[model samples]
Target: MLTSDQEIRELLTAARTVAVVGISDDPERDSYMVAEFLQRQGYRIIPVNPRLVNLNIQVLGEKPYATLRDVPEKIDIVDIFRRPETVMPVIEDAIAAGAGAVWMQLSIVNKEAAARAEAAGLKVVMNRCMAVEYRRLMPR
Candidate 1:
């Protein structure tokens, strides 16, 4: 797992495209807030939410894809906002989608899924908010 300040900072610096799985359309949600923040930081946000996609709701000015595989562009990171029990499938999709890293938001942690993602050669970060890490590590 890449949890060190330097490692996280490096990942944040190198990452350009983030696939936000389980992103919500509501602004009150952390997923929505984080995605919006990343968008403003110049990282392309690919919203992945089946419900929003079905409803034709766009998040952060990008069409929400039903899954990571549905996204056509290369994904640098897969940011997950789902529950711990539901994160395995998202990790699987991230590995299959060829993402460089897997980031599970705060309060979400799955050791087995993290192991699987690491085995697939993807950097894993569990129980951390990407936005918070960005603010802490990349203060301007």
Candidate 2:
């Protein structure tokens, strides 16, 4: 784990635009709730999911990208909601997309992938809920 609260706080403070990879169109999903909360907090939320491509849909008012490579702008953070085994490719994509950080949502952790992302110069936050951390670390 990246054991620096101050660092995490700083990261959260610096990040204004987040690409929510694996974000769901279903409003009841955790990914949706978290992304929604971030949007409400003034962050630009970019949803990414292959299903969106199939269905021609968007999430939370922003158009969904089929992949990180499909996004046309620089992403401050790549917030992952996929399973552990599916993370490596996403990490690689995040790196290729020039993202500043990779945030794995609650209960998701891939040490090897995290290492790779960190080695590639991107901050990694794993096994934590971004929304929870944001509420705890950032003052309103």
Best candidate, TM-score: 1
Model 1, poorest ten-residue lDDT window?
60-69
List model 1 lDDT by residue over 31-68, tens digit each. Answer: 99999999999999999999998999999899999999
What is the overall TM-score of model 1 with all chains considered together?
Answer: 0.98
Candidate 2 stretches greater than 4 Å from native: none
Q: What is the lDDT of candidate 2?
A: 0.93
lDDT of 1: 0.94
Error of 1 at 121 (Å): 0.2
For residue 81, model 1's alpha carbon misses the true position, in angstroms, by 0.3
Residue clash pairs of candidate 1: none
- Candidate 2 has a TM-score of 0.97
lDDT of 2 by residue, 48-76 (tens): 99899789897899999999988899999
Best by lDDT: 1
